[model samples]
Target: MAAEKKTAIPKDIVALSFEQALAELEAIVARLEGGQVDLEESIGIYERGALLKAHCEAKLQAAQTKVDRIVVGADGGLKTESAEIG
Candidate 1:
């Protein structure tokens, strides 16, 4: 009998830090770019990469919101600026 592979749960992603998720995403990109992985493996990696990307984005957005809440001015007013910055 062969050992069964465990399916990844949503909580697994929640547990991963932004850095760890980004690292995994980079590895996935490198593997796909190398053109060595088969179609099925590539698809699986792509899916995982997408999830990691979303998780990273969410973390970044949350951090940005936290930073934006702090206004740096003598008057102590809410800072209003372009949310999308290059």
Candidate 2:
């Protein structure tokens, strides 16, 4: 079972929702930090964590693109500007 888990690839990792990916990533971090796994398993989980981190970052970037900032215009009216959140 452990060998199968190491060999399995999360093909849907990229398709996972932001919350789902984040939760899985957090779990991986906790498991890795627990110091119970050997080096090989640690490397496998670390790779998965990297993918999860990328997915979360992409989700955040996509959400940021849709975010708009409200600013006061010269005519004393509210205007919207594309806000970039890094």
Candidate 3:
């Protein structure tokens, strides 16, 4: 049988939400671990997974930057402080 051509991942990878990207990455890992794909296909999926992982991380970092913690001032006033994300 002839080898099948590997298809590219769908468009707008960076546009995917953090959850979406993470889910896709998880699926890629499962597929890779399953060991059913040919080497070339595996390479393609691995590349896609890398992109997804990076996108997810960026989304998370952006979200972290927006997160804030409420603090009480000495005078009992409320203040918003950026939360540190590790």
Q: Candidate 2, after superposition: displacement of residue 50 in Å?
A: 0.4
Candidate 3 per-residue C-alpha lDDT over 3-66 given as tens digits, one digit per residue, 9 for 90 to 100: 1213333568857878888998999999999999999999989888877876676677665337
- What would the per-residue lDDT of candidate 1 be over residues 23-66, giving only the tens digit for each residue? 98999999999999999999988787777777787789875342
Cα TM-score per model: 0.63, 0.61, 0.60
Which of the two candidates, 2 or 3, achieves a greater lDDT against the reference?
2
The pairs that clash in candidate 3 are none
Q: Candidate 2, after superposition: displacement of residue 53 in Å?
A: 0.1
Scored against the true structure, residue 23 in model 1 reaches a CA lDDT of 93
Cα RMSD for candidates in order: 9.4, 8.9, 9.0
In order of listing, the candidates' clash counts read: 0, 0, 0
Candidate 2 local lDDT, 39-76, one digit each (tens): 99999899888878777877787753387999998999
Q: Which segments of model 3 are wrong by more than 4 Å?
A: 1-11, 64-86
Candidates arranged by TM-score, highest first? 1, 2, 3
Worst 10 residues of 1 by lDDT: 1-10
Off by over 4 Å in 1: 1-9, 64-86
